[model samples]
Target: MSFRDEVEDGRGDLRKPFLHTGSWYRMGSRQSSIMGSSQVIRDSSISVLACVLIVALGPIQFGFTSGYSSPTQSALSKDLDLTVSQFSLFGSLSNVGAMVGAIASGQIAEYIGRKGSLMIAAIPNIIGWLAISFARDFSFLYMGRLLEGFGVGIISYTVPVYIAEIAPQNLRGGLGSANQLSVTIGIMLAYLLGLFCSWRVLAVLGILPCLILIPGLFFIPESPRWLAKMGMMDDFEASLQVLRGFDTDITLEVNEIKRSVASTSRRTTIRFADLKVRRYWLPLMIGIGLLVLQQLAGTNGVIFYSTTIFESAGISSSNAATVGVGAIQVFATAVSTWLVDRTGRRILLIVSSFGMALSLLVVAIAFFLKGFVAEDSSLYGIFGILSVVGVVCMIVSFSLGMGPIPWLIMSEILPPKIKGLAGSVATLANWFSSWLITMTAPLLLAWSSGGTFSLYTVVCIFTVAFVAIWVPETKGKTLEEIQHSFR
Candidate 1:
């Protein structure tokens, strides 16, 4: 049977499928107060942008968690009397917590709604930071890090998905890229603040993003697509109207969303066995492949151990250099935000992977040459400087595409019916790979700095090939439209 035929399901008059509820009326009254007609008439983009910015804070918190270890590693290790292995475990435990969180994130978002899930995520992050700040022992510190990672894992999946769902097709790429942009800002803030603040103070500062996010979430509408899928038809239409602008005619768009949802068995639980279907497995493969490759490229390793990397490169002010790298990353991601819609996802990803490969190769070569020269020799110092340059270039390359695009693509390509289960699996794979890379980076670097980066370079090279072969271009497509392309 045709998809449309199956979805119609004897429901006559498709145009009248939705019926208003008392709850939608209540929501409308509140919406009227917040979204005065005068404001909506001007341009609807502002509302969507505001919502994206608010949720973007979650990723800022995510970035702060990722960046926290870099600046505070030395101070925290000394204060807690942690060994190299213990500190590495400390750095990687967030990934462990994130893996657990990733496993549950999809179901939580699916059950509670995206806005509610984010609210749940914020509480743990705030508590996690507080625990880290007041901790007098390693146990508290470890617990706090785990809690923070748990929050980050949820934020990682929900923010991009939320942004993609709300944004207009023309704006989706840029808005989605904002997730990574905010994350870079968070990382930058952590690095910058770490320079001036003690480790405890930095931990305390990490609480601010969630503090802002918790209140901000109440102001935005729940995702319209999620509402539609759950049979909250009236609320879904109202939410979409508010996002698109009260003055905008939303009939065609509303119908499109209805058809998309109706085509699926909305209440049917997707089994692991169902994933064997071409439609289900194809997007799943693309989503999972991108996410796993994103981590295997060793981003967290560079981020978690950036200070140490700079010190090894012979930089006297390694902390300051780490901050500079953070700044550069934020700038690169910002450029990517502007370019994603215009240049397209596949092109940017291919270029990003190649640039990362080249940059890591440079670092590998610099480290290899450094080992052959005397420590005090001119060539040794030059190679050290070269390694620093390579790391910066690698970060810039990564931020431009690999950092943002995978999450964007994952959110875009997956069909709404199976997104929750499949997204969790993909997110779990990402965190697992991250944990492996983060846990082993210190040991790998100590064993052979050149070899560690050489391995990453090889991964980056493979990423280029994977994107060229398997990944699709998702630029300027609606979520429903993108899903159809996979078929």
Candidate 2:
């Protein structure tokens, strides 16, 4: 009569089914009765807040790296006596570090708990920030950037997994949005700090969250799913008790865990060869393709080089232009917090791609006509407006699809056994694509600004086409349900 019994009885369609568990329902019950009906809501609420705070900390590091580097790239270039090519190398190398870190962190997380993995990630972040604050030469600065990139990669891969594992099925989308929200807020904070103070001061401030939050992490509980995977049944039940918040049948929960774990354990060890199977390969392709599409839309190019883009478009104050672009990014992501669950992934991606293509086309036209408008104030005004539109479009587009969903989808798509490896591969793809785009932006700018924007516009068109054909609808699907789709 329990939920697990019903599943075993084949009483309902397993395909596209939503299991009511955790704090939401009791087993053998047709109605969605609250588990431990009195206190379940209270405990789940507290647990979610804790997860949000911890996950949000990881994103501040990402925001610091993504936002701080751009406005100060020119300053660092001047101070370090470096050429444009060196700056590009700096960006690419950071991505290289990120690529390594993401892969390593997955195994670490699997060995330790998600909370412990995140705490470990925070160490390099704090060190990176401290090093950047006092970096005296290009080499030291490059080292700091690499360290920061490594920390970001770890945090990015681990935090979403933690959130997904801990969050209740009904609230997953909203909680997942917190991760993106934090990143946007972090970016906004970094830009504001960079605007008002020296880059060193901004870098120094970046270390504060790591210092303040490290102690708080100890009080948090390990993920129930992770505990189950480790065969820590007592700890898993205890963790679930805290998470679920009510007196409920532990039997159903334990059985569900056993079913999932059994399924995973029967699978072969994840070799690169595992990805050759269609069941594994399809999700991996989706993950990598999403990252590639994100970069090809030139989101990072516009964000990291917004000042240069604005200057080329005739903006006078590079600092002011970059700040404006940063503000647009924050606002657009904030809007996405509301839009993502409501609008669904595919719609947002399609809309964003078209919007980006249109904005880039306008920017390309402005760049192509630069000679004719050299002295025209009206043309400058028009160009500035279009640049702002482009930035807004990029932010909105990215937040809705590329910014948050890639990680969210990747976390859910793979089976638990391969989750760590698959997540690492997907994240590596993300960093590599980021490196490719960031490293190429400056060269592309120097070669032909109009041509670069046009190229991105073309890429966006192809991305839209691909999304329509290949990406499955993951909206409202449970982690297990998502994986089942591929099979």
Candidate 3:
């Protein structure tokens, strides 16, 4: 007998969604959400990789928007003759657009299916980039940034959920992690290109991924789990076979999917109120909590203010330190992708949380000492080195787990019935926390850099406990198995 046989009794628990939760949430309400999956013959791994890569482009676009202003800040400001206050608003409008996008993403993805949603998201991004490329005024830049941010917001939720739904259990962790990897790559590439290209040329380049993604969507299979949820059994099976390889036996997988679907209550509409159940609420809390902790770890505060921190620590070239931190984040996140499947999710999260706490404490101490010592004291040199080390260590710890794992786990554990709603809420919380941290970072640093990092240290320590106690290992589990563990 398979694991399903032994766990048959628990199917009753899964059925709660269909009987109650689905009713309130309008589950499976849209049949025409997306076109039918295309017939294709290919290895399962190739199909999965191809799909992930295509979807991953959205994140690259997201990163480009994020990194664009940093390198071109002076040039753009000078060319546009904008005030610091105006430029500040221009910088921040993206978060506003993202929050709006987060709230709408669930409804959009659910109504149109993941592929259709990506198509919708692409339109605005292309238009947004064009607006930026052709802009002659500050308002144009503002509108363009807002549009791109909104598009990225939608893509953020869809890509991970799409990847989670399509990836085979064995490859899920690594592939899911690719979303973060792509974002980092985009940021790095943007920074590198900004060195040579004019800001307008760079803005035009932002259109590249969306251009590729629009056509690329046609080649990949629609998510099989999505097909199964929509009650299209034939298409569901066909999609699964394409993902698993044309010649592979899908009988065992099909039975498991059938059992998984059967376990859910399929007789009702979806409802937001359905979240009162332990099954749904538990995973929702975990996803949102991790996102909260990820932000409160003060990663953004450090990123936003790293140059200043280095300057305070007595470094002559703060920009070099900032760039070094970015490189560390990209490298650490890259290593994480390889280790996620091999080492498992829970362990990495725990290690990451505690490691960050420890690193922040070092910086906190360094900053605390900066005030009392004489400027030319020997300790000043030591403290400067400590700050750099602390900041880099924090970046390494974060990139290893907290940075990517929250997004990966968020994509994995939520049931399809509540994925859009729950995912949107979680994504919103993440951006909210990011905005909060970035906005307040300078304030906190001015008040007391030590105090700010100390607060972050406390949060990271709490995260270590939270993950160790609540986060389950999700390395090799299917999406169904992951949701099951939440109970």
Candidate 4:
């Protein structure tokens, strides 16, 4: 049975706004209440910025965990005497662990509040890294990867929600983008550092972000919305006050938040049966489709084994090339942040998917040609250069849109009521697809690098069609308007 069909027990409505928790906070009961009150007063952005930066450490650690495998693959495998299959398992195990963590993430965040969920995530990440660092055998290494993946799964959901809940609307998009940007930064850090350190030393270094985040979490106030949701009104007001600065009046924003919370809290838990309606199922399908396709393009396969991919391409400085790709990913993602709002979601996605398809096709063809020429021949060297160029362009294309837009569109399109459950389903699909790609990438490369990427190229081509036909233009429309169009 499929995930959607089998998980239909629908025990309860997800009690939290799992995707973008604070989107409703911007809803006001009266337009004048938003405009005429002293509550309209602006607070210093400093405090909010501080909180975001502190929590951003979580995504950075997440990126570090992901990029860790690529740089350390050779060293770790040699040190532990692991075969190719064993090493692939080591790389893919985190996605399995992350799947477990993602499943539990929403409820955990709901039960304990956003800050608490992050603390919960951080502990496992620390333990996971230490385990990897101290490992003497595959058992420790595998366990560590799983632990790290589990931590990342929770972080994947919680950090963005937490940042959204705290930030003002004006700052929300930019600040939320930080989560992804930090992740790329973290990946680059791993690639750069891996060039010098042993795998063990790199694992130890991975623990540093969480170590700082734990104590830092203590200083930042909890999400006011989460506090309000849990019926801690006094704490909620105080938390909002702290976030807004000491003297900024929060009465207007508070009333709006209370109204939103009251309306939301009264909602009946959604059931899978409700998805029979086109309005519900359509968005859910689009959300899951985008997420799954994002992974099926084999981005993680390339990322997890980038150093090995470079080596196979006959690049002399494969590790350095890996570091270069990581740096390019960071820059490309930053450019994407600027382009997403201005250019709109659908355009970027179409462009991204098409670009990836074109880029992968180049890689596939280059690899195919490499087989025809002698290794020392000039033509073979040209194919090798073409492969590197293709990989770099593919990553740049992915960062431009596919990397961030799927989640953005998912959050924008999913109905608020079923966001918790539906978002989980979508997230699970993404992790599962990632696991499949990462697990098979090494074996596929062993079989035929050209064939492996040719498959991805077809997936990306399908993605371009999917986005163009099925995905709606969500830019410049309210959630209600977007939903209405679906109806």
lDDT of 1 by residue, 320-412 (tens): 888888899999999999999999999999999999999999999999999999998999999999999999999999999999999999999
Q: Each prediction's Cα lDDT score?
A: 0.87, 0.72, 0.80, 0.80
lDDT (Cα, 0-100) at 333 in candidate 4: 89
TM-score each candidate.
0.92, 0.86, 0.88, 0.84
Query: Tens digits of per-residue lDDT for model 3 on 135-158?
Result: 899989999999988998898888
Query: Which pairs of residues collide in candidate 3?
Result: 18-265, 22-269, 22-270, 23-269, 24-270, 24-271, 25-270, 25-271, 26-270, 27-270
In candidate 3, stretches whose alpha carbon ends up further than 4 angstroms from where it belongs are 1-42, 263-269
lDDT (C-alpha) at residue 362 in model 2: 77
Top-scoring candidate (lDDT): 1
Q: How accurate is candidate 1 locally (lDDT)?
A: 0.87
Q: Candidate 2 — worst ten consecutive residues by lDDT sum?
A: 13-22
Task: List runs of model 4 lying over 4 Å from the truth.
Answer: 1-45, 224-262, 266-278, 473-487
Q: In candidate 4, how many Å is residue 464 off?
A: 2.0
| lDDT, residue 38, candidate 2 | 39
For residues 1-487, write the lDDT of model 4, one tens digit per residue.
3222333665433243222223223332123255544243235478788888999999999899888888777788999999977987888888999999888776677666688889999999999999999999999999999999999998887787777678765555556667788899999999999889999999999999999998888767788877676555656776787678656778888987776566455333445665566668889999899999999999989987887888888888988888889999999988987776577778999999999999999999999999999999999989999998999999999999898778767766766456556766777888889888878887899899999999999999999999999998766554444555765
